[model samples]
Target: MAFGKWVKQCFESVVDPDKENEVAELTQLLQAGIKERKRSFVLAEVLQDRVYKQRHLDQARNGIYQRYLARAWADGRVQESELEILSWVSKCLDIPPQTLRAINLETARPKFAEALAKAMDDGIISDLEAAELTEIARAGGLSLPNFVEKFFHIEGEQFLRGIFAAAIADDHSAVDVLEQLVATAAKLGLSRKVVVEAIRPQAVQYIEHVLADAKEDDILTSQEESTIRQLIETFELPIAVQVYIDEELRELRLLTDIKNGKLPSIAAPPGVNLKAGELMHYHGDAVWQFLRLLKSGPDITEHPGVLAITDSRLIFRSLTRSGAFGFGTIVAHDSSRGVIEVQRQAKPVQRFICHDQSRIPAAIFLSALRMANQTLTSQDDKRRSRHIPRDIRQRVWQRYSGRCAECNAGEYLEFDHIVPVAKGGSNSDVNVQLLCRNCNLKKSDKI
Candidate 1:
């Protein structure tokens, strides 16, 4: 009946491996003692000192005590459960969930605790606040202490101030002001990681605000916003964020243009045929006019003599004796002048321009026209055409023995324009020479 005598009997019962019922009875007794005493340490020490099977008794004491605490926390009132969990947590590294809630509610630990207490006392934080904070902390991968410290350090005081100020002014969106505070911190060079760490404790609320703002502003498409968020996870700086935004914007523009029929939908190979997505290298007024006509629906019947065939730019030309369309180079004419004149090719050949076919597109063709007009206006001297014809390109390739001039690599040979198209060189024979794609791209406009 006495504590000492009862403990002695329990110790004996615990160590007797053959006495299964006695061992079970001893465990129950030990658990009852721990619950009644409400002291695990005392129970542990008593088992260690007085029990016959010291190790087994000690194990039973700790295990039963922990189970008791866990059950009580799970079943009892939240406050009582939290107190018990905290007590156990203080003695060990892993705190129970109830204890974590208690710690979150505590306004006494340090800076964060003090701030939280003030906010709660001022009615700044509602009942929902604790749950929000907990969720945020879990999402941010921050411990309770770390989450509190970072949140208070970053925006806690400012947020309280904003809330009080907003309440006084009768503004409903007090939360928006707090978000602006966080954005201001970001702009002021607060590391994204730091902001993320601080925000995780209030992740749900922060996310709601983000979604609302996105909807209100209509600043980013859903895809763009998702990409931004992903990039934010990887890169947490403003510059990196801006770079991604710019890239997304450009892609969006391209997609929109393609969708609206401003840009073609099909992919056309570069060189002769003008397809929607193809790159053209030629620059000339005639080519520009041709591209414009193609983009605008043309009445193929108007040009009865015009023929459609593969591998030729002269779709419409005067017919020959054969019923099949004859292939010939058709000269471009200036209708306004009522005269036949040599067609001026777009100058300063674009090394890598989008192609409709081998021909230039309307957009780039227009750019060349503007450049040419500007050039003519600026200079009083007679304009001399500077182009390299195909014959010259072949001759140059023959001169180089069909090998790279610099490296003598012979697998792929191409015609290289010595003067870049941007600089007003033409695709004529005199200005062009043969080089491999590698050498051509490498040489670029250097010469």
Candidate 2:
């Protein structure tokens, strides 16, 4: 039979003591009606004034407890006052403590379990539901956790998981949310280990998101590093996760050093010769494209070679031809796709394309070129205008809607020279444009 149907039948089988006459008849007819009708006085008189056999009284005691349980739970909840009344009724009728408990559990345990399920339907237990659950537990003569444990041993763990998840949903570092999580877990009688395990998955995801954002620019700023460090401490992240974050930070620091012109020198390639004090910054396999003007069209020729950037110049050596351009002689350089195009004074632009157009070579080459140019500018007395004034910067940002010109991307944007400063580009509004990291890197090999 369905559980609901059985509960309904149990409540309907109430027996009344006022109508039962025979001392033998009383045991069978006396069921739930005594408590439902508030006739505990009549039951007391029947037991005290009338003479009945001991076995009959024992049987009658069981009937009275069942009827009292049915009446107390008739409205789908048992109140604290009803529990007190049940205790008084049991004492007056001299029902054994074990017998009374057995009757209550048999009749009320299923009802309490069903009610608890309903209260947790929305994954929350409200104040009213908590009070009601407490009352129902008392009616069954059990504590709240003990009462729930009777139905499901892991209910407290499930509650902790749900509470922790909801608390950290918005801001994991929120003090109030943390306090609430700890308090709720304690209330459920859960340990610190269980609470930590429940929240670990979310904590890992949050840390990963923050780390990804920090690495997006290819350099970790001091502020970003500080924020990530604070998060790790706040969450008490495990060593396994900390190791990954540390590796990313190390790579970012290297990139930061490269951009700041602290790039380390490497051994020169076989065909490359360094001038006095010229340290090789980069050397790799590359394809060099030479453009020639002809009647039919602009003829293009490709040659495979090794391209090297030193502290002084860019050198490309091929089996057929070799050329070198000192930083002082160069007018401008630009990059697109996989090619770096250098225009020298009174010479055709030389385009060197690196393998796969990797950003590492591009970054090293740009950093070396920039540092060399800075040295030239500082040694020369001819003042060059390179700094963009505040007004021009504001105007350019507004005109571009703070997005890249090439890709329409909005992140990692930079102010670029339409004609590079190395090529005599000005800081005027007409020459400045916005480009995202990828577009800027493609245009000038700038990280």
Candidate 3:
């Protein structure tokens, strides 16, 4: 019944014949624990039952993934959440991201292949093929690289044109679409200037055309002014071109508000809780928009959002729609006090703007985290069922007031397992809450 005996016995039960290195480490730790009169440590727990440890973790990963797949299926295809988690889930499980992506591609490949075949039944991806093609692309889950070795155009010029036309045809929609394309191109290692240049010929013409569409009786209305404001911040234009645009906008009386940064208020519905449920400890003014260090891009790059420090987490919710421009929560490096780390994806942690860096809630965030479990392990490993019952999803949805448990906004909601289905959490209504896609990304079930 002694701790040392249990540790030795569990060590012997490990079936790996090629784990002499691990065995040596285990024995060393056990000996040191006994010599130091330390009864147990967190590392000692993993030796208790190797099978349970591995099996539980595997089931946790699989269960949550299955839940994602099922939901993705119900939504008619794979989703961004399903795609993004492939990296984090693999990291936590200590598997290669490429391997997880390969597995995903394997399972998703055939259904999409058949869809693609149907789309090409007419010999071309015409209007009859457009919907199918979109589904196929979503399901393929391949071809996009983390970095650009060379400029890649596998998506085809027509595909790009289709995207551009679909996104830009509407005058109001063009402003948002341009931002999105810029962001996406950035992921492909294209600078904003490069992206603007690629479309330079049309950029001016489209800007003028859209502006004309916005004018009413040759006078820009309030709606047109707002549109101009949204379009005005893109700095990729040449100084001279920007000057011309500014002069034109001024003539149309749309320059002042755009230049001064007049923006729509962030106030949500009256009863919606805009803050986290508990730990309203932070008393600082929630600056409407400040820049955070960009997660994985240029050093000068920053995401605009209000910095939030609350009971549950310290998160930077981006000002961009669906949190399209945010970074990760501030997490601790380990159990070491005062040694904290920012959990970011895509890129290594970089410095933020000086003003924003001064506002990081690292001290309080780390203080709270130190008191809790050092490892934010998922609960899915030991749950009774990974499948959440529909009734439970409905119940949890109502419990959260039909808003994202993370960010109380948006109506296009998805059910997220609080403990993550892969970690063995149930599909019971108590286990799930509705979150908009943006909040879901912010609150991914992965570590």
TM-score of each: 0.29, 0.47, 0.24
Give me candidate 1's TM-score against the actual structure. Answer: 0.29
**Candidate 3 TM-score versus the reference:** 0.24
Question: Order the candidates by TM-score, highest first — what do you get?
Answer: 2, 1, 3
Least well predicted 10-residue stretch by lDDT in candidate 3: 331-340
**lDDT of model 3 at position 402:** 51
Per-residue CA lDDT of model 1 for 1-447, tens digit only, reads 999999978886676554555446557766565456654435445344444444454444445534544543343223444555545633432234564444433322333344355435543454455544443343333554466666555455445444434442342333444355445434223444554444432332222223222211223355545544553443343564456445534544443443233433233233334435333222222211222124566322211222222222222232321122111222222111111112324421111112222111422222223333444332212121323443554456557755666677553344455675546767665666655545664564243
Q: Please tell me which predicted candidate would have the highest lDDT against the true structure.
A: 2
lDDT of 2 by residue, 1-447 (tens): 999988865664454343344434666434433445454545655555566555566777667666776788789877778877787778756788888887777666777667767776665566777777767776777777667667544665566556555554443543345456655544434455555666655555444433433333345678667756765665677887788677666766766777677887899978678888889987888988877777998787888988888887888899877888787887766643356777778776678888845445656666677787776544222222545565776667668855678998654555667897667888889998877657876766542
Tell me how far the alpha carbon of residue 427 in candidate 2 is from the true structure, in angstroms, after superposition.
20
Give lDDT per model, in order: 0.40, 0.66, 0.45
**Highest TM-score among the candidates is held by which one?**
2
